[model samples]
Structure formats: C-alpha cells, structure tokens
Target: MFGLFKKKSEKQKLQEAYQKKMSEAHKVSHSNRTQADKLMAEAEEIAKKIDQLKV
Candidate 1:
C-alpha cells in the first residue's frame, strides 16, 4: 500500500500514543486503580503535547 511509504507526523504519533495509554488505563482500571490512574495521567500529558503541536 502507498501508506507504507509514508511516515507518521509528530502529532499523529502523539495522538496514537495517547489513545494507547487511555486504552491501557481503561483495561487496568478494574484490577489496578493506582496503575490505571498513572496511565491516565500519562495520557493526559500526551494529550497536552498534542494540543501544543496543533498551535
């Protein structure tokens, strides 16, 4: 596919990472509240970076 030749931009990479962190946080929430909170915080930080990149 032509997509293979393309690289992700910084914003795209950060967004993907944020989504992944949120999903992990959701999955961990039930078994480990503390870890899930940590993941959520990380996702928040990533979200901030994504916002900064948008400007």
Candidate 2:
C-alpha cells in the first residue's frame, strides 16, 4: 500500500514514542520503581510535545 511508503508526522511519531515509553514503564514498574518513574517522566514530556503541536 502507498501508506507503507509514507513518513509519519512529528506528532504521530511523538505519540508512538509516548506509547512505547508508557508500555516500557508499565513492564518495568513491577521490578524497578525508579526506572518506571523515569520512563513515565519521559513519556510525559513526549505527551507535552504532542499537545503543543495541537495548539
């Protein structure tokens, strides 16, 4: 499909990154609180950027 060749937009990329980070955080949460928290913080920053792009 043509979609396969298309590049993702900045916001879309950020959203994917955010989702990935959140999932990673969730997986890490059970084992390491500190690492999970760090991942969550990074995810929040990405979410902020995605929000900024919407405005």
Candidate 3:
C-alpha cells in the first residue's frame, strides 16, 4: 500500500516510544520496582510532549 512508504510524524514516533516504555515498565515492575518507576517516569515525560503537540 502507498501508506507503507509514508513516514511517521513526530507525535506518532513519540506515541510509539511511549507505548514501548510503558510495556517495558510493566514487564520490569515484577522484578525491579525502582527501574520500572524510572521507565514510567520517562514514559510520562513522553506523554507530556505528546500532549504539548496536541495543543
């Protein structure tokens, strides 16, 4: 499809990164609470950027 050749926008890339970080946090939550918290904090920052882009 033509869409395959399209590039992702900044927001879209950030969203994907956010999702990846959240999932990593979820997986790490069981083993290391501190690391998971760090990942969550990073994800929150990315979420904030996404929100700023929307405004």
Candidate 4:
C-alpha cells in the first residue's frame, strides 16, 4: 500500500505514544491505580511535547 512508504512526523509519533500510554493507563486503572496514574503522567508529558511542537 502507498501508506506503507509514509514516514511518521515527530508530532505524529508523539501523539501515537500519548494515545498508547493513555490506553495502557486505562487498562491499568482497573487493577493498579498507581501504575495507571504514572502512565497518565507520562502521557501528559508526551502531550506537552506535542503542544510545544505546534508553537
């Protein structure tokens, strides 16, 4: 597919990482709230980086 040749940009990569971390946090929330909180914090940091790239 043509999409296979496309490379992800920095912002896109960060966004993907943020989304992955958030999903992990949501899953962890069910049994390990502390770990979930940590994952959420990491996701927030990624989001901040993404925001910085926009400015």
Candidate whose lDDT is highest: 3
RMSD of each: 0.7, 0.5, 0.4, 0.8
Q: Model 4 residue 31 lDDT? A: 100
Q: Which stretches of candidate 1 lie over 4 Å from their true place?
A: none
lDDT of 3: 1.00
TM-score winner, 2 or 3 = 3
Candidate 1 yields a Cα-based lDDT of 0.96
Q: Which candidate is the best by TM-score?
A: 3
Candidate lDDT (C-alpha), each = 0.96, 0.97, 1.00, 0.97
Which segments of model 2 are wrong by more than 4 Å? none
lDDT of 4 by residue, 1-55 (tens): 9899899999999999999999999999999999999999999999999999999
Candidate 2: residue 49 lDDT (0-100): 96
lDDT of 1 by residue, 22-41 (tens): 99999999999999999999
Candidate 2, residues 1-55, lDDT tens digits: the string is 8799898999999999999999999999999999999999999999999999999
TM-score of each: 0.94, 0.96, 0.98, 0.93
